[model samples]
Target: MKKIYVTLALSVALLLGSCGNKNNETSNDEAAIAVEVNQTTENQTNALLSVSGKIQSSNSADLSTRMMGYINKVYVNVGDQVKKGQMLVSVNSVDLMAQKAQVDAAIVQATVAFNNAEKDYKRFKNLFADNSASQKEMDDISANYEIAKAQLEAAKQKKNEVNAQLAYTNITAPFSGTITTKYIEVGDMANPGMPLISIEVQDDYEVMAMVPESEISQVEKGTPVDVLVKSINRTVKGKVQEVSTSAKNTGGQFLVKIALEKTDAPILSGMFTTVQFPITQKSDTQMVLVPVDAIIHDGQLSGIYTVSQSNTAILRWLRLGRIFGDQVEVLSGLKADEIYIVSADGKIYNGAKIKY
Candidate 1:
């Protein structure tokens, strides 16, 4: 009886062990990776070409002097608003003033000489006609009158030149604008060609961007673009005002000028900006489309997560084309009606079980 009881216990123990192992295997098989997925579709959309640039005033100038002198006074500060022809700076003009005085004295002397010569010439002409003066005397008087007249004209021209130089001693605004930069101060020695101040027209602004040679052909004058001023955190509409025919000397990139629409918001020059150029390329065949978020970077190559027919996750490498807003055009390595992983809360890999 004891042997029979021991045999029954051994059989029951073996059966329990087998059942536990089978349950563990079933649990492992049921485990799957959970991720949100979407099916790609074909579409025709205008591709957006994004290029970075800087905000600049459509009318900006680096105000400088043409004559060298010590700065006597700066009437405007960095933020001063000035009108066209308004005096902004005054250089040391004592020397210029003295020079003008000398010119004035010379001009006065020449005027007096000219008057005397004219009177004498008239008198001599009358005397010669009346036979009171000889022909030799009239010729000599005429030559003296002509010489005095020439000297008087030359003196007047010299005075005018002196006055023009005197005007330069007082620098004036070329246009109505706000002073953005002040490089010269009182008592600073300023030289010709040295920038003294900078001004920008407050109401006029534009964005300047560089485009590569390959993309320059797509950008055309009058094409509308979207400009984003990151500093202001605002997006504005702009039009292509000008496109350079030749490439830049340094980078070989072509320059593109975009004129922004007038806005009440304060848009200053030299602010960083991003410009989005809309370019459309027609194709005989449709292209596959996927959200920009769906694409992943794999160190020099672009790829996306795709689902296999068996509902397993697989990483697919793709050749991408133009980008359109949130969607990107897929040139190859993907097809229409294909299921792709859009979002995953957990780590995923190739051959990983995907749960819908």
Candidate 2:
């Protein structure tokens, strides 16, 4: 009976040891995961309103002609630099030339008649003074002289009108600029008000941006701004030149023009940009911002991994706002005092153990 009792006690001790080892293995598997954490904070910064914009020349125009005729020759080509009053295009002006020739001939004939009438009027006036001519005779000569002078004046006016019309057959640059487009080629028919070329002053550039009605009131003319050219990855200084008072034609958004300062960066027209307007923030207001890389996206939803009270990851959806440089504005869903996981060494999911 004593031997059997010893064997039973040994078996019971072995079962207890096996149960203890299993519990230790389960505890090890639940170890805390390594992670990097950050405490959310608010910042007092000059609030910037960022909006998409496009770079363009402040002075741009589509050159057009006023006469209808076949194009004779195009003096300037696309990408050519031209000066003010430089001839850009010529239209077929053979008809205008013929009209001019007729006008000139009429003026010459009128001039000869005017000279003869003047000589006769002087002779008649002398004869009347000497009492050698009748009153009716002198009056007739005077009337003839006046009629001849009127005809001469009329002919000169007609020539002036023809000359003015001839100017329309030649197209000239209104201002010094670079030609961006050419619409007419040799032999193409040119009509009145038809655009022939497009020109722009490339050195002077500006940004055109639209601001929501809610924010337009905060923007004022002469305010300085920063324009970020996305294509060249450059930020240039600029000043707000205009702010529309009415949104009637801008699809409910106000248009704002920003004049960029001179820079060596290769900025071209139609380049995409982001304009930042610095606004003064009230003392009580603050903005919450987070690193862009820390935010995860799921289709249209955006969220960030946050640390829970139990040291686990909790994905919190976020309402994001405009981006500022490498960081993004967090409008809601995250508190200023809460802690978030910026990065982790292992995969993170809901309820996954983490350690700061």
RMSD values, in order shown: 4.4, 5.1
Model 2: residues >4 Å from true position, as ranges?
Answer: 1-44, 116-150, 283-356
* Angstrom error at residue 62, model 2: 1.7
Tens-digit per-residue lDDT, 53-138, candidate 1: 89888888997777789999999998889999999988887887888898888889988998999999999999999999999999
In model 1, the number of clashes is 0
Prediction 1 TM-score vs. true: 0.76
Superposed model 1: Cα runs more than 4 Å off: 1-43, 212-220, 248-253, 285-356
TM-score (all chains, Cα) for each model:
0.76, 0.74
Best by lDDT: 2
Pull out the clashing pairs in model 2: none
Say which candidate scores most in TM-score: 1
